[model samples]
Target: MTEQRVAIVTGAAQGIGAAIARELAADGHKVVVADLNLEGASAVAQEIDGVAKLLDISDEAAVARVVGEVVDEFGRIDILVNNAGLVPFTPWEKLDFAEWKRVFDVNVNGLYLMTKSAGDVMAQGGYGRIVNIASNTFVAGTPNCAHYVATKGAYIGFTRALAGEIGKHGITINAVAPGIIASEGVLSGPHADGFDYVVPMQAFARRGVPSDIGPAVAFLASEKASWITGQTLVVDGGHTRN
Candidate 1:
């Protein structure tokens, strides 16, 4: 029988993060829905019979506290999904230093802090899976979103380097880069018009959804991917054929 694992998915209040949380739960793993939106996280937790943790991943103190609490309650964390991030659409000329910092705070620094804290615990346990959420824009390169793409590129680099360092402890770290997913946030945000432009470009000729990403994340978190590490699985329905 396969042992039930404990997972922590950040930014799980909605969108891709929420879908990953549900997918992991359906796989029979005890999931922790961590998000800044406490109510949303709690609701998802109830739906999946998992735990809800209010977290601001950019804050080092908050990240440490959540890791400690989860470890104390669950004994060990087997999966850590760094899915929490910010996506801002602004032209490069208008993208100020403050805006760039804010984006990196959640996308880059947040992932680093979470990985450092959780990876330490996983190293001690001698088994762990770290899956980071990146974007396909880093490969194809998009206009008006340089900061977001740079952060994802940083994630890929970090995953490769960290995997080499932590593989000795049986911890595998990888990344998933999704195309323009039509999640609730994108549908109502300024990027709605982007779908029309993106769909025609995709080889699949369909808009990507949140569910499309869940299974991929689940696979990376599974024992079946034991030998896979420091890789980026692009799930964009062949949008960016890299």
Candidate 2:
């Protein structure tokens, strides 16, 4: 039997992150549910028969510590899913500098910290798959979250640029840009009211759920997508097709 790959999924306490964790676990990988919510993370870990980690990806020390702990326990990290981010829905007029900075701190800086830390371990192993969660708002130019859109645009750019450097090490870094996913965060926030208006805009009339995104991430993290790197797979129900 092939050995199970060790995967660390950030923001896996709920919503799309939790769904991704479930999919990875179902793939027979040893998944680590890493999130700030200890209770939620632990619940997901128990369901997957995996480990739970209290991680704040924006904190440099916390990022290092979690990576170190994963390395110590698993000896190598095979996959990293950068799914933790702040989704602020403030319009340009109400968008203050503090809110913008806060969003960037998690969406961009946290992404960088996790990528660097996990990537170092993957380099040592000479094999890794890094999938970043991005948003289609960058493409659609969705209003009322300019900061969020900017961060996701940076993620797509980062994925493309970093893939060149990491591919030499047998690592593939790609991104998944979701559109109008009805995740817990969105359901409880401002986007909940917009979906009725948003669904009709999609190639498919139905709204997207967390499960809709999980399989995409699993495929990208799998051996099947080996040749595909530096690409952004937009899972927006064909909403932004070229």
Q: Please give each candidate's TM-score.
A: 0.98, 0.98
The lDDT values for all models are 0.94, 0.94
Q: Candidate 1 on 148-219: residue-level lDDT in tens?
A: 999999999998888899999999999999999988778877877788888888888888999999999999
Q: What TM-score does structure 2 among the candidates reach?
A: 0.98
Which parts of model 2 have CA positions greater than 4 angstroms off?
Answer: none
Query: Where is model 1 more than 4 Å wrong at Cα?
Result: none
The number of clashing residue pairs in model 2 is 0
Across residues 1-242, which tens digit of lDDT does each residue of candidate 2 receive? 34589999999999999999999999999999999998999999999999999999999999999999999998999999999888888989999999999999999999999999999999999999999999988889989999999999999999999999999899999999998898999999988877887788888889899999999999999977899999999998877764
Cα misplacement distance, residue 86 of candidate 1 (Å): 0.4
Instruction: Give the Å shift of residue 142 in candidate 2.
Output: 0.7
